[model samples]
Target: MIAERLSLQLPHTKVDPRILSALVCGSALALLALKWTRQRRLQQKLEEARRKREHALMEMRTMSLQFKEQNPSVQLEAILSLPLTELVEKLREGSLSPESVLYTYMGKALEVTHEVNCLTDFLPECVAQLQDLKKQKQRGPLYSVPISIKEHYDYKGHNSSCGLAYFLGTLAQEDSVVVQVLKKQGAIPFVKTNVPQSMFNFDCSNPIFGQTLNPHNHKKTPGGSSGGEGALIGGGGAILGFGSDIAGSIRVPSSFCGICGIKPTEGRLSLCGISSPVYGIKSVHPAIGPMARDVDSLALCMKALLCDHMFHLDPTVPPIPFRDEVYCSTEPLRIGYYDTDGFTLLPPCMKRAVQETKKLLEKAGHTLIPFNPLRMEYVVGELFLKGLFPEGASALLEKFEGDLIDPNLKPQLSVYKLPQLLKRILAFFLRPVVPRIAGELKALCGIGSAKNLWKQHAAAEVYCQEFIAEWKKLRLDVVLCPVMGPAFNLGYLGKLVASGTYTVLYNILNFPAGVVPVTNVTEKDEEELRHYKGHYNDHWDKLIKKAAAGGVGLPVGVQCVALPWQEELCLRFMKEVETLTREKSRSTIGPRIEAL
Candidate 1:
């Protein structure tokens, strides 16, 4: 009976400790195996993403080759060889029809887009617009003129993605104020160009569209976030393009791609209806302007956009029409120039451009005064960044969650991830030791509160006052400086902000600035770069080294800046520079070419 009871009880009893442990281990293994299978599936998905990117790149290259084959005459020099004023004059006098000009540009643009990846949105309606202009027998300054817009600006029935994938199908319900103005002036908007994700980085790359290459040299980047517009204009596909600059967006690409661009003062042109990730934060100002192959075209576009109706559309703008009197006069003016910012040493090509420009201005009887920037390091490093993203740019970056961040913007996001409290603690601790650098650090760490935001605004006002004071003391009308180092090779702009030293200062001051191509790369310029000694000992040094290493034969450009609301004066300076450069080239080539 005991044996029988033991057998029955054993059947009902729980397993021994080792057996129970074995069963639990088996179940856990099964779960882990299932998880491993899921993880493998995820890995496959990632591989598929990479394959898609590669396929897109290949398709783009193939299309570029086809474009080149179809239009062999569309060379970089060919695009920049003629002035836009002359082109427009010919079109007006019946030498070129609207359709002919539009087709030429469209063909070229189609070709360039394949190679450079410049277009994010293109409209077939442009063809119809040109056709209507041809039919109506009407013409204007930009009539039938093909213009490309950066993706940030709104156009009715188009996606103003601003290069963000999340906003992919979100089409605009109506045109931005500027877009309507451009249309009313008879400009045909053909293409919308690519930008950096969120328009935050100097390099242009986003999940929505890839990268744009410098037209002069494909190995180098066309600078951003207006990089696509810059490349399109530079490549001769479009006569004019529109770009916005809060920090070096217009100027950097203009410099890198060997084109002319203008950044007007804040509120000069209407910003109403423009789309951006960081909307509603107006602490730092972004002005819209024109980019083109020549300065005259830039001036013309500016005049057309700033007509009377535009000011009425946006009440915030001052009722300042294009001041033709300031631009048309040929009076000698006081110009200020500085070779280096006392922080990062400029590349040698840039130094030569400035030096050569000074010689030309002096010969023309203009007063060339040497002016050092008023504490640029303190301003850009400290104040500008602090005020730019007051609420810490979290919203802008969060939109890209799970997407691969551009290598150039990775460091920026890391800085953004730290707690605001820690950043403030660091700022307080370091304020007494190195106030300017500390301020810069605090800004980078996004430590500003409501009180801090107000303080930064006040600081900006003081800086602006100081800048005006210095200008008054020197009695200067315009300032000249290198836009950046020799155009950085494509794909390597992730390392430094030194290139922005020239343009960002103007942006911070809300001054009008323009870029004029002065010279192309030469053997001598390349040799000088081989032995460059940069002033700043940081990532700037590394950036300089990379730019110098293989950046031979690229174009170099310089900035010409005028006081706030002085767009007309800025164009005048640009014209002077252009004239001087052409005359010098002619003089040098005269005897050699004649003998040949």
Candidate 2:
């Protein structure tokens, strides 16, 4: 007040206007200089982080290669070639030593890591732990069995960076709940795999760890946010690996990489200590589960995790043990299936993959009924997208406050960066011109207010209940549907952002969904897809067709969905699909795993 009064009073005796102008200009320049210095300092810190990350990465990569090089032709085949189920059985029967299993998988995983940049942290501590476990007289189910983990699983002393440069330096003080359960059951977690920056995008890439590519074909993405685990398991390096799914993080990778993944309903497996960007926002809670080469492997890993040990570790998880009866049931089921998700149309390969599976299920004596895709425009546009960013994406954006952004996240950020006024204008104008992209952009804008966010939350529950009621009305036991497919070529995610509607729907519904590979993309499927127009013939369909082009021999997969908490039944259905796929392939009845 005194300063204001003095300035106003002194206005009658003002200094030279030129001098005042110069002073004002000087102040502005100083502020700019201050900002410039802060940015420079930030750049220096980032440079230091880069050097440290590069050094550690090179050392780890070299060490991984050395493990491969040091492997003698002795017993690595027995270690690497056996499926996870067989590996565990053999280990239980004393067919393999703990050290040998660790060494063999370590060597093979390192080889895959070198090719795909998958493993985020190679834990030598795993070896020490294994050696210690070897002395125990009593063994657990996963005794001497090697398992891989998604990078988000915290292991004491290692950072769960999840591809973010900012999270690179902070070390975890304790193991995550999943890690504890795995260790208690005697599973050796030797390596943690890479994920997208912030674990948000479907393509796994970051400045710290780079991108993870498909092991089957290096030209295509492995699918993410669990891309590293998908790459590891798909490449035949890890027997069973753990990953988390919000949308299709686990299943998309499984579909893309020709593996199996299970997304148990929320609270089935504990997420305690698991690193996630959207940790507490639970409208679509991220569920942690297992990914593997086959359905049995998935079940085995799930059984190990969904035990009393897990409940003890995190009391939040319901004390529900794995249900053997549901998994072991042999009775035929009534299944509902669809080729397209209604939001994003399936390409020919994807449609064919589902069609083939539907036929196989029918032939296997399971009744198959056509299920229309539900209200995906609202499910995706209003419920899921709004639910995720209901707070206008502040939680999601805070991680990038001063960090280097990944190219994979660039397109998503564009939507997040748009002004509310601009979004409204675009929404109105694009509603008729390009409704699909408009809805997507509008969804990405996030819910602007708490009232709107609450509506979205209530809307999600209502939608889930409505979906369940529909399922009951139709008497559908399980749903077999096309997963978003063809293992997209790298750099196409920006255009194909909506391609994941197939997987995201289940997340919103909180369904227990598992993915299984049905067939590889054939020349015919690819050719047909090139000229393909989807059911709706919308903009998304056109974009999908473009993305699916040249995807020949890339794997196509179908998602097996059951009601929430029905993971065991979901796995059982996935097993049936796997069994029927094998039988059909043997009889030359339909699409084979290898199109060639």
In terms of TM-score, the best-performing candidate is: 2
Give me the displacement of residue 427 in model 2, in angstroms.
Answer: 0.4
Per-residue lDDT tens digits for candidate 2, residues 1-596, read 96579788896766788988999999999999988887676577656655754565565556546655775544777678888778888888886766667767767877897798887777767767887788888788888788889988899988787776567678899999889989999998878888988988888888777889999889888989999999999998888898989989999999999999999999999888898776667578678889998999888888888888889889999998889999999999999988876667777888888898888888879999889867888877888778788766777888887777888788788788788779878988998977877887788777777787778888888888888988999999999888887788787775566788888888888899999998998989877876777765777677677666778888888999999889999999999999999887787854454575
Can you give the TM-score per candidate against the true fold? 0.85, 0.92
After best superposition, candidate 2 residue 95: deviation in angstroms?
2.2
Per-residue alpha-carbon lDDT of candidate 1 for residues 1-596, written as tens digits (9 for 90 to 100): 96578779797765589977998999999999988886665456445533644454354344446655665664534433457777677667876666555556666776787788787766656766766777765576677677888988888887776766556567789989988878777888877888987888788877556777778777778888899998888887788899999888998889888888989998888888878877654446788889998888888888888787688777788988888898898999999998888766777888898998899989989999999888877777556676676666677777765455666667667667767777678778977764543565566765347787777778888888998999999999999887875667655565565556677788788999988888887888778777776774445565676765566777778889999889999999998998898899899899899999
> How much does each candidate deviate from the true structure in C-alpha RMSD?
6.8, 3.0
Model 1: residues with Cα > 4 Å off, grouped in runs: 1-82, 135-138, 419-440
lDDT of each: 0.77, 0.83
What value of lDDT does candidate 2 attain over all alpha carbons?
0.83
TM-score of 1: 0.85
